[model samples]
Target: MSEPMLDDDALLRYSRQILLKQIDIEGQLRLSRSRVLIVGLGGLGSPVALYLAAAGVGELHLADFDTVDLSNLQRQVMHDSASIGVSKVDSAITRLAALNPQVQLVAHHQALDSDSLAAAVAAVDLVLDCSDNFSTREAVNAACVAARKPLVSGAAIRLEGQLSVFDPRNPDSPCYHCLYGHGSEAELTCSEAGVVGPLVGLVGSLQALEALKLLAGFGEPLVGRLLLIDALGSRFRELRVKRDPACGVCGHAQ
Candidate 1:
């Protein structure tokens, strides 16, 4: 198939990125044709959605089951006071459309079951696990694994945040299940545990960067490495993660 050409407007809008030696015109065009799925519209999802749209991702599938609350404005920058009581997906689409109308936005306003999730994963080039809890993360990971898509996962709680990428197409890549097993209910929520606002932004932005790298085929992505951030102490840490052969989700034994 012939590659799509970027028009004059697209070239101008993305000229700054195109100027980079690593990106140039080819990388910008790649980004403009890539599709991404982001699960969640809360704190982490806010920046992930914004950055990917601003970067000119061709299509974005946004899935979120919650309604925006006034409290969300603290860190969920995608929504505002007017967005309160509105479905997160709707609110996000409004903001994302304004950010880049050239990018297509699809909103899934309900929680996705296994079948729906798998369908969404199959259609997208990449999946971003911005969900707040483990169950959703595990489900999203499973869908990505089943579809053999790249997964960019990010989480923020209290003063700490972590980000990782898992590509089922890579045999050596460790999935989310490999790091944190299934059926473990730790329930460390931001509301109950009290998260700092900027922590989510920090993690979500990294998730966007990873997704962009994966789609653009640029720098090395964080496939087997987990990045940890300590907001209170202002420190960052990295840990090597390996695929668990016995992992129920992506292990060969499964």
Candidate 2:
């Protein structure tokens, strides 16, 4: 498919990005031609959907089987009190549409089984695993590896957060399972362990930035590194990750 031409309003709306040589008209056009899939529509997906929609991504595929709850309003900034009972994808659609009417929004408001998840990953240029569970992250990672697509995965719990990018296209990059095998004993959700709202916001915002860098074909992605956040001390740390040749999920992949 041909890349869509940027209209006059689009040029003006994204003028600041176009002003930067790293993401000039060509990069903006690439973003406009890209399609992305976000696995969850909670805290991480909230910022991801907002920024990508505002930045004029041509298509966004939002998938979530949950609905907004009153408790989610604290960090799920994309949804409001009025949308407490609405489907997260539907609520996000309303917010994203208002943010950027130019970007097309596709909703998958159902629990995606193995076959559906594989199909979803194969249909997108990239995948963002914003789901707040270990099983979902592992599932998303496996799908991305099978499809040879990039996956930006993030997690936040208590006062800490984690972010990483796993791209099967890069042999040096580690898949999610390579770094976190089977699952960690430390996998805790916000509901069980508790979390500060802003910590999630910060992590989600970074996830959005990483997606933009990947889509625009500029800046180095965190493909072989893990970013750890300590919100209690406001400290950030990076850990180098190597691909595991013996990885069961991605060893035979790519």
Task: For residues 43-134, write the lDDT of model 2, one tens digit per residue.
Answer: 88999899999998889999999999999999999999999999999999999999999999999999889999999999899999899988
Global lDDT for candidate 1?
0.92
TM-score of each: 0.97, 0.98
In model 1, the Cα lDDT at residue 11 comes to 91
lDDT of 1 by residue, 1-254 (tens): 98799999999998888898888889998898899999998999999999999999999999999999988899999999999999999999999999899999998988999999999999999999998887899899988888899999999998999999999989899999999885457767788887888899999999999998999888999999999999989999999999999898899722
| Backbone clashes in model 1, listed as residue pairs | none
Off by over 4 Å in 2: 1-3
Question: lDDT of all predictions, in order shown?
Answer: 0.92, 0.92
Model number with the top TM-score: 2
Model 2, position 168, has a per-residue lDDT of 93
